[model samples]
Target: MLTVSIWIASSFMGLALLLNLYRLLRGPDIPDRIVALDTAYVNALSLLVLFGIQQGSRAYFEIALLMGMVGFVGTAMLAKYLLRGDIIE
Candidate 1:
């Protein structure tokens, strides 16, 4: 059933998010933390998409798009800051 499939997908995404959180907390370096944060953002996006499917709502899709944009910007800034030690530069 569609509902069962959605539940399973949601469970997997939840697990992924937990793993990402562990990495973010246990990272031995800043870059590792950054990557973990990026991955968390992606997993969160997937959860949002799954919720959108389950609820049949367009708003979740819109929110997911917005989050994806923010995630991209955040990831880029994190990488840039790590490389140059200044995000604005």
Candidate 2:
């Protein structure tokens, strides 16, 4: 049962990730690309968490956490750059 649920969730996450990738590549505007990138990271994070749960592994959790932090910072910087044309003021 648990394995079945994990497989279902993984499939959905994979679909979302692919959509985000398409948006990132073909976005008509910078903001659109940024939003797509942000969602992609979030989806990736969820996938990592799901994998960790399925495998009963602690290491994947740490990796997911690390990526979450980095993704947040990167997204913030990108937004700032889009707004002010410079990430650091």
Candidate 3:
């Protein structure tokens, strides 16, 4: 039933991604949009890891790591901009 579990996890992640997208589109504030984007990134990473495991590929894991790094950087920059109106000092 490992395959079944993987499929279930993938479905859940996909649903989460869609929900996050809705939030991103309709967020009432900058912070809310940023938070939704961060959550979407995390869900994407989990989906990547699951796909990697299912396909026995290491590349997906690497991509997920890179995406995580990018997501963190993006979130930080967005949050800084929201607070100070600029990403650069």
Model 1 lDDT, full chain set: 0.96
Clashing pairs in 2: none
Q: lDDT of candidate 2? A: 0.97
lDDT (tens digit, per residue) of candidate 1 on 14-43: 999999999999999999999999999999
Clashing pairs in 3: none
Candidate 3 global lDDT:
0.95
Worst 10 residues of 3 by lDDT: 80-89
Candidate 3, 42: how far from true, in Å?
Answer: 0.7
lDDT of each: 0.96, 0.97, 0.95
Q: Each candidate's TM vs. the true structure?
A: 0.97, 0.96, 0.96
Candidate 1 or 2, higher lDDT? 2
Q: Write the per-residue lDDT of candidate 3 for residues 7-84, one digit (tens) a residue.
A: 999999999999999999999988899999999989989999999999999999999999999999999999899999
Model 2: worst 10 consecutive residues (lDDT sum): 80-89
Residue pairs in collision within model 1: none
Stretches of candidate 2 exceeding 4 Å from the true structure: none
1 against 3, candidate with superior lDDT: 1
lDDT of 3 at 79: 89
